[model samples]
Target: MAEKTDDKGQTGQEFPGFDPKSVEAYVVKDPQALAMNFARALENLGKAASEWLGPRERGEIGDSVADPMTDLVKTLSKVTEYWISDPKRTLEAQTLLFSSYIGIWTRTLNQFSGQYSGQPVASETDTLPKDKRFADDDWMKNPFFALLRQLYLVTASWADKLVNEAEGLDEHTRHKAAFYVKQVTAALSPANFALTNPEVYRETVASNGANLVAGMKMFAEDIAAGGGDLRLRHTDATKFAIGRNMALTPGKVVAQSEVCEVIQYEPSTETVLKRPLLICPPWINKFYILDLNPQKSFIKWCVDQGHTVFVISWVNPDERHAKKDWESYMREGIDFALTTVEKATGERQVNAIGYCVGGTLLAATLAYHAQKKNSRIASATFLTTQVDFTHAGDLKVFVDEEQIAAMEKQMNAVGYLDGSKMATAFNMLRASELIWPYVVSNYLKGKEPMPFDLLYWNSDSTRMGAANHAYYLRNCYLNNTLSKGEMKLAGKTISLKDIKIPVYNLATREDHIAPPKSVFLGSSLFGGPVDFVLTGSGHIAGVVNPPDKQKYQYWTGGKAEGQYEDWLRGAEENRGSWWPHWHAWAEAKDDERVPARKPGGKALNAIADAPGTYVLERV
Candidate 1:
């Protein structure tokens, strides 16, 4: 048998075992420390079990997990029915799996016999997906792990195909099935398990199982922190504190309401835009995402650009605020912020911006204002906002009748949806990046994740009032009422077309929460002039991208008509952040200037420091 060298020059002889150098890399030196840590890890594991069981023992948690999962099972059943119901299709699926498995098995045998090509045999084309999970050398060097990786990828791809080609299912059902398939496949990936994952296997062996001990200890701590639920930690929570290191832009909470605190940021310039800027951030997460740090803070950037910034920091709602709905948010939250901004700036009209769900609420408010002929907001900007749900992306899969009903029942039980629930949902949108990577690093590698301001802000989840969430899911996602001229607000049917304010609608190209297509389609619903700009990156990074970072590009001069892809083709791509483009567009709307005002003006007095107590309230 001839030895084969891979692209990296490692020979076929390295196929079966952990190379000495590889094993030596993770070797633990202190036996005594390892033993002590192992014992501590075991103790923590026991504590974790105790924490998990304590709630069940006291009947604090319900055993009704299946109630919500029932919809998922039913949704997935449609795909199963499509395949299994037809004998020919079922056989085709089985044959596809068996053929792929046979190929992998043959390649494994060839490698073991030293009669293989150096190129990977992980997929049919000898090319693997660009997945970091299988980046370890052992994944391709070791026959066993290679076989597992290939088999898993083939099966997962087949599952996706099944959903895609399935017949007799409605579009919604098909989308839900496909989403569930991705989730199921992601969870069952070989990299998720210690024995199956080559890297974890090496770490465990070299550390004499010390890695497992540390991982278990961390797992216990995470479960305990989640109050018996596993709140997967993405970053070192202890390293971040609101207003201390994160959300560090100077400001003061000048006005407080039942639903929100209006923070008037200290102006950075001697003179500021006469029309104060009011930001409405989604209650689903803390407003601090926009003000994560001075470097990344959009609020700080706006202030520096001579805008008197006022932000609405929504409360982490509980049972008391569960009854508050969208109208409640409009009147008490946005309207309250507008009034506060007026008092603080001595301005009647202001430029307004909304992010994610916050943008949705702002759009509705604009429509309501249009109905009332209220021109308080001279210009409106929506960041990654969706007015139409036709192409709302994967999130719509979770908004069907059964799922929303289940969510309503759960939220009704507590008067508000737990912040963790929403956080988990958002994480699932990019589980491959958001959920699994952290799971592997934190619990399997026994490493504390790096402290990141953006991730810390992401982890600081906020509860949604029962009425508010239900109304949002139904009106925006389910009914698509907001885009249609049918959504009733403040006892009157309002339309986006009637809102004649100059609009700067910003959509991220890679946004999952609000798909670019949905945002583009939504632009047509507005009667006023809309400057629809598309920028690079996903939901958070795309919006928070600062010009100083010189990261990501933005597109302009494209009409938000026809397909998003079509518009994208004609759009001019410019280097760097979209902030400057937006700043130019907004300043064009109304660039009047006045002397910078204090945190609280002649009427309203300061309530607290910037980032307000409402944002500080944790779930």
Candidate 2:
């Protein structure tokens, strides 16, 4: 058997003053300064401890009747049994790991002896995934760190192979196993720690423990901000405010309900499309993601493109609104938006856009309307939404029967799931990118992250109403009822097949929340002329992409039929954002002209400014 090498290695990657040759370079020459900062760091750690315990002391923390991690342990145990159950299989796994380590050891010895060239020594077959965490040259140039990196990689790769190759395990179990393994490995990565991470170690030595002091102080403050939970700051929160800096698109809250507030943006163009545009954003986060700033504001872009835009800004639900379910969201939210759009623009019909879970709700609403012969919605556009959960990515791992029931018990106690809980789950999906990077930069390096509108919006999570969340998990993820035509909304059973309205289904190439394949499969569910467009980038960037920036490319002219791969093969790629392309497609549907409408028309009076008070409510 041949050993895998770093065929895809970082060849010319350089870090300033990263040479391991100077032992004196790492010496903490200033003992007094180091001691002083170390003491301060300890004080900050104490503060962090107090912040964590304060909530529990005041009985503000949720009761821990069910252990979520117990399920994780059990899931991993199953995988463990698959390997250890057979001695020969276990030996083979052990041999594979040992061989990899041996190869690394031999190469390091040869390099030290000046017998081996300073090039990749292993074969391409033995290559590991390109991990940005170990991008520092010390991970390769330094023998100690290089050995540690290889050992960790070999072990992680072995664990992954075990789950993937494991027989007799059900598909769901396997998925959960794989996801858990990845998470566990990510959490245990050497780069996350100050001592193990060469870069963090250098920073610590250079700063004479000052970085730790600052990092610990920030850690304490973040814990206090999260009400005892670590609300890790991915960006400088001080640099942004909802209406002042972010969500700056001018609009007015035309209508308000317990479940949502309908905001109608002030038109930018002299003449607007006869059919208004209603944007239904997921309640998992704030609606302002679409209106982050003037540069990235999708709402503003639509308003400028000659469309009267109305968005449903969902409330951050509390115990008082615990009973609000999916039907309530549809009736008081999406349906309410339609009504608000009509009042604000005097148009009975309007083009609708739904993003993520909001799109799932919109699909359900369309089906319900179809049965009742309601044709208020002229056309629909779905962005990174999953109507079919069959291919729904790792989010499904958190939605099994046992887990959902456990989650329901927790939500039932509080009447809603904490916004932070959902935020953590999302961050965990891309833990390597979202979680560890921030941990290294903010906590380990003792540095304040730069202000990023997208990350700020990412952290601004929204609470999930108990009833609504339960319905979604059970119907959408658990049974996959929505796509199967078995989901019941209100008193009637709703099917995606009944949604005959023209659809502009946009799936991003790299969407993790709603996988492209899942969205592609969902395109076939609607009984309409579906124009499925595949765009570049993930869930947020792909949808929020403006044509002016011309960042990622998009693909079109592919029929939403057969496998997603097949569709991709025949699709035509176009450079730049899909916003302009979508606008043209929508205009082609109904290009009738109407004078630009006011934020609040004669029928509906303005309740508040744009973005609304509902979005301002924090959990």
Candidate 3:
């Protein structure tokens, strides 16, 4: 018989052909190593406490303490006032919640009594939903625990209804209340507590509470190492090294500037497309994400498909780059990159692609160039990017006037917005998936983190300039000026509508950073034909999906100018990577295939090997 496997991937019984003793033999832990780990953790805790108590870090502590409480107070005041004014409606909501829980218990009881054979309640999304926190735990399957889970879900639903129905609250205020409500509700999940969680309790007992000690040690170490706020090191950092195991694409640094370095990848095909492809990755991360490994590298895939690929490796900005604004990124970064591509490939017109914030900047550059009547770009592609920030997802919660002002002060103090701050915000967006799970595994259960390439990339973050970050938050996010044609760069007002080139847009169905609807809206802004493809998985996984993986599916035939739902209604689902579709579209745009060109020509000579110097700059 086949062995049963739990969610954590541990089999209930050993494989029929394998010896259980062999597995146990390999799973040895040294007491001396554990003692050393403990010692290091203690040292880190003292260092962290000293830093936290310091005058420079005290301001940050104050903001951290104030912001959450401020939002909580506002939410509570509004909720209380609404409840007081509509006691009848509030009571009705409570009644509905009670009814829902009672109905759940009735069904559960029926199943227990063998009267029902229906499946247990599950979340609508295959992935865990934000509010349905108790869905994954097997303990929750027990009749008693199941009822508790149902009660929590019902209460959460009722809270959301109350927050939504609260009259006299502004949209922003309502969103804040809903955000806080979700946080509070999510914390109350059965999975979070050892007493409530069977798995954690089992592990705790099995380890004789050594797991708790290990967890505390790990937590202290991370805190000392300055990643405590984010919590849990998701990847074994010692196992993988950059430019070795990770980011291993072969290329040469053909061009360089203060803000960016253009890496022209080695051609994989003897013949290549006439219009070379230039990739502008977000400055918020290392460019190596696009070229993570041989099998997963999009740049390698593009090259293999007979296209000369070039990627911008952004500088890890410091105080020296503090004065650099969005315009600097445009003029010195994208503009310079275009010149470098032309110089190297001898192609006056090149195809450009951008991911995340890079796509936002690319859109702006296209409009900026259009204003100058410079038609250098043949086509444009956006990967999980947002030009319209009006509905830019939960991230909008951190883009308010007060938040922006506070951010500016913090950045001013530091010269750049620290990568950790950005990492913390992004983690909060999926706290259940990213943050709390790590907290549970690393702290509560005292397990070592599994090595993951993607999580490592996620942790490998980059700083943002004070001026640039401020401008982006205030203009693009706060005012929603980019889509409105109110955003200006180099003395000219920019608009996404002026981007008349053939556009290919990709959005992930489960992306928290760039919602599919928000990404699809960029299609309407473009003056040219738009091909928007919605793929399964979250932001990074959705884009990095290579054909060989065949892990997730994507949908085609979506209209860029229509509502996301309408597009979804008529779209055709395909069972593999979107790379082939993208490559076919790109090839159609180019004139003809020609003899492959080398990395550099006369003006733009190859400076250094691929995955260049700037990528090595870690702050």
- Total clashing pairs in model 3: 1
Model 2, runs deviating above 4 Å: 1-22, 117-119, 124-126
Q: Write candidate 3's Cα lDDT for 1-619 as tens digits.
A: 3257889988764334322442232232565654565565456556555644553465544444226567678666887788777779778777877777677767676645545433454532232234444545443445445556666666777788888888888888787788878777766777777656656665655554566666766766676566334334887878877888887777789989999999888787889898889999999888788878889988889989998888998899988888899999998899999999988977889999999999999999999998899999889999999999877988887778887887888788768998887887788788778877777778777788888888888888789999999998998889988899999889998877788899999999999999999998877888878998999998899999999999899999846655788889889999999999899999888649898888886667788887778878764
Q: Rate the local accuracy (lDDT) of all candidates.
A: 0.86, 0.88, 0.79
lDDT of 3 at 360: 94
- TM-score of each model, paired residue for residue: 0.94, 0.95, 0.85
Q: Over the full model, what C-alpha lDDT does candidate 3 score relative to the true structure? A: 0.79
What RMSD, rounded to one decimal, does every model reach?
4.0, 5.6, 8.1
Error (Å) of candidate 2 at residue 181 is 0.7
lDDT at 37, model 1:
64
Tell me the tens digit of each residue's lDDT in model 2 across 77-187: 998898899999999888988888788788777655555543555561257666789888777766567767877887899889989999889999999999999999999
Clashing pairs in 2: 4-126
lDDT of model 1, residue 539? 92
Model 3 TM-score is 0.85
Candidate 2 lDDT score at position 206: 87
